[model samples]
Target: MKKSTLLIILLFITIYTYAQRDQTNQEPGSTAFWENLSKLCGKSFEGEMLNASEKDQFYGKKLVMHVRTCEDGKITIPFHVGDDHSRTWVLTMEEGGMIKLKHDHRHEDGSEDRITQYGGTSSNSGMSKIQFFPADQETTDLIPYAATNVWWITLDETSFTYNLRRINNDTAINVKFDLTKEVETPPTPWGWED
Candidate 1:
């Protein structure tokens, strides 16, 4: 019993140490990454209500994504889940534009089933286009096919917003967001039952 316990503990330590090293060795977040994500920082923007298709989802229940940035050059996007008034968020730019957007879902025993992921890519648009790549399989599934949630974020001093939608069949059924116009919107993310 003692040997087994020691082995497990040592394994956890090794894993933790590796994760730390991996994070520290990552590149810094691109200026474009911050500039793009910062567009929605102060505004209390809301999206339109929508729904999910056969394999699609909107996560409606009144979830709110609050954008903010700390002094340490880190970005915080807090997503408020309406069902239990719980909150999770996407913390970015720590080791480059690596993002970890967590969910409020949980297993039967109260163990949160939230997902952590990485996103963002090389500054390819003269600070205009930043690729939000999926770091893993789970994150990829969340993407809406070729019409995935990958955004082509356009940023400027006047406004900051993103459009996360794609064509489903012959129609753009899951139009996730279209608020880059710098205008106030409905109380939910667009592209679902409203």
Candidate 2:
């Protein structure tokens, strides 16, 4: 009798779980739904100088990627060069949540530049590691598959800042992004994903 009762209880729980998931999928118009679709937003951080010693003599230029967005195991970074407008960076999550920043760039001439590798970092420990890939040869739906390079990102609520470096790229060396601003985190599409 005890075994039968336990089996019945388990069966009911399984049905309830499936019912909840189905409800979420077919729900009517909701801002929450749109928010859930957009996994990235509401992140802010301060940029700054980094220890040039990490790369040693091979250190690339200093740089910064501010207000980067990462959600659903992916991150799209938006950054501006010194007085040089801005460009979008796409990074994707890999095994262990390591970030491989897709190598891609747009020239002022509206042309695509070669994908070069620099270096990357993550704040939430090893949850994310910024590694370099060749170019957008392949990518997941989460990122630009054409990207020859990319990065992995782990989900975290706290804001993080990273110094940008261009290694083995045609750009100049010793460039760094100094964090000089702070902004409010806008509401997440998922509302409470934070």
Model 1 lowest lDDT segment of ten: 185-194
lDDT of 1: 0.44
Go through the candidates in order and give each one's C-alpha lDDT: 0.44, 0.41
lDDT (Cα, tens digit) per residue for candidate 1, span 119-182: 3332331233333432344656553254243433333554334334442434333223334533
Query: Which candidate's TM-score is highest?
Result: 1
Model 2 weakest lDDT span, ten residues long: 185-194
Which ranges in model 2 have alpha carbons more than 4 Å from their true place?
A: 1-46, 51-64, 68-71, 95-97, 116-125, 128-181, 184-194
7-121 per-residue lDDT for model 2 (tens digits): 9999999999999999767533222222332333434433333354555533442233544565665555555443332355555545543345543455555455453323342
**Per-model RMSD to reference:** 16.7, 11.7
Residue 129 lDDT, candidate 2, scale 0-100:
18
Best by lDDT: 1
